[model samples]
Target: MTVTVRDFRPADAEAWVRVRRAALPYMVTTPGQVLYDLARAHPGRRYRLLVAEEDGEVTGTAQVGLSHDSPVPGQGFCNVYTDPERLGRGAGSLLVARAEEYLAEAGARSVYTWVPDEPADRAFAVKRGYEPRRPAHFLHLDLANGTLPPLRDAPPEVELRSAADFADDPRPLFEADAEATADEPSDTPAELADYDDWLATTWHRPGFDRALTSVVLVDGEVAAFSAATTDGLTRYGTAMTGTRRAFRGRGLAKLAKNDSLHRARAAGYTDAYTGNDAGNDPMLAVNTWFGYTVCATEVRHVRTLV
Candidate 1:
């Protein structure tokens, strides 16, 4: 069967999510989120969701777009995934070709992608002129079988709250996110300076589980947070866990994460997942202490578009 690549359509939502979940189980995705992503994307992003079909069945998917949130211009991304059982087909190459073409036409000077930390995957990226940059791990915790640590009580003057508590005004949470994100380790650093953009893209995202997203407040100020996402069923994922600079050594991050995880378990989520840059030893240690084990690794690869 020949593989063909084309732009994603509304009808492809289910298949797209299925293929993505099958290939990258650690990540959370839903049809509604996928459609929302495409519809709400910034024009500067030039985002395109592409699917590879084999004999009319969707076999692979790619998210191609420029990094609009990054201060750097001419930076693009094309993260592709294929159904594990359907590898070795031409779908991946076709997807890459089209994605790179689109990005180059969109004025991108370089493209970045995440390649699984396997010999074959690394070789494929290298063969395509992409060089390895940073490594990241996908950590998993079995909410049903694995034991989670007990949630600790917040210290005096500090309180644990749900993100939903800030529904009236999420500006504090947004401020915390911007500060934490600026300090995060990433190849394509982001600057969340625009609150309106954050509301539209991050806070209002369909996957964001505000009820389960734990926030730590000290003296009524955001100190730390663990943003959570769920599949609306059995899977839970920590989209981001960060402590404000002033609260870094206070163990507030772990506190927020534990609260989120404990509530997630009570809410009937069976699995939890998160990812951290390999260089981020602090977060890695925190995740390990929470019983999360590294399930997979992906290497960031970049290629200059000449």
Candidate 2:
């Protein structure tokens, strides 16, 4: 049977997550998260989730969208993933073709994607005109067996708090996220200009564990944070970890991440995962110090549309 690419449907949520998990186990996501994200996506983003189905089974998925929050305009993205067991079934090609067409229609002048570091995957992107850009590492920590570093007491000037503590007001977290995100290394630099959008997408995102997300305060101000997400079962992941510019050298980011990781282990999460750009030395060092090992790598690929 021929593989068919179509817009994601409500019924495909479970299968979509399954295919994504099979293709990229390091990235944590769930069926509810997929549905919630689709429902709450910003209209300006032109976000469209595509699924490639073969014989009524989802074999691949693609997240196609315009970079609405990017500093550069006319930029788009299409990250495609196919189940390892379903390779060579043409699902990947169909998904990418459809995604490109959608992106072009949405007025994108260039598209970016992350291709797995494997030779076959790199060849697939190169054949489609994507030129390699930057590389990123996917790190994993064996939370069940590996030992985490001892949690150190925070300095008298630093206070540790969970994201849940800011239930009445999350603007402080947003401000810190924006500041840290500005300094992140990436091919497509993003700026979180709209607080409402941030609240809708990040703060209210499904599976975001506010109780496990640790924040560091310096002199009563939000200085660093480690946002966490979980499968509500045995898996835990760090969504983002960063420190404000003024607090960069104080080790506050490490403090927050350590607190969050310790909380996750105590909560019965057996596995933890995170990704880091090759250019981000500080973060890579932090993850390394936490006993995380690089499990996979992916190269960012970009193609200019004429």
Candidate 3:
């Protein structure tokens, strides 16, 4: 069985999406979103999608790119996934090799990848010279069966609204997202300086459910928000849940997330997922309040391209 790696083609959308969803069930993805990402990637990102085929069947996929948006330079990322049933057939290793080569050529000094905390996945990264770093947790909530916290009364000056209400001008939503993202704990820090790029890659993404995204307004200003992403079916994810700097410790983030989850369950989504840095106690506490349990853990692994 010969496994070959090559650049992803438009026709490989379905198979690629299948492989990714199978390997990483915690994230939301679709064929159209996959294609859009490939076509709309930032020029500075140097992004590339690769696929591994064995005997004419695609079994593995990889997303390789530089951390162009990060304030820190020389950082890159390469995430690889293989069909669970096709593991150990050399497809994963082949995809990783190709991804590293591409990233190295694109002037990346360090390549970071996420490896499941499971034994085999960790072994694979270790064998490839990658070292373990900070860990992240993927939490799951059975929206269909799990009981969500009742919506508490908002502060007298606070009002709950949907992201859709700001369709005419989402700059305020973007500002809230930027502030919250800047405070997120991660190995790579993001600087959301461009409104146009955010509009193209985030606001317009296929799975983003603006109607379900809950926002808290304090006296007519954005205070906290929980962004929602879905597959237009049974799957739902919390793309981002954050409170602006001034709103910290006010419990507005929790209110927004709770409202979003209730809305999602009402919309018939069965599975809900979210990820958080292990060290983020505040968000972790919020999720726990909603009965979210740790479904899986993944550690960030990095290797220098030198």
Q: Tens-digit lDDT track for model 3 on 1-306?
A: 899999999999999989988999888899989999999899999989999999999999999998888999989999999999999999989889988888888889999999999999999999999999999999999998899999789889999999999999999999999999998899988989999989989999889999999999999999999999999999999999999999888899999999999999999999999999999998998999999999889999998888
Per-candidate TM-score against the hidden true structure: 0.99, 0.99, 0.98
As for candidate 2, its clashing pairs are none
Residue 71, model 1: Cα distance from true site in angstroms: 1.7
lDDT of 3: 0.93
lDDT of 2 by residue, 152-216 (tens): 99999999999999999999999999998988999999998899999999999999999999999
lDDT per model vs. reference: 0.95, 0.94, 0.93
Q: Candidate 2 or 3, higher lDDT?
A: 2
Poorest 10 consecutive residues by lDDT, candidate 2: 244-253
* TM-score, cand. 3 vs. native: 0.98
Residue-level error in angstroms, candidate 3, position 96: 1.3
User: Which portions of model 2 show Cα errors greater than 4 Å?
Assistant: none
Worst 10 residues of 3 by lDDT: 98-107
At residue 11, what lDDT does model 3 achieve? 99
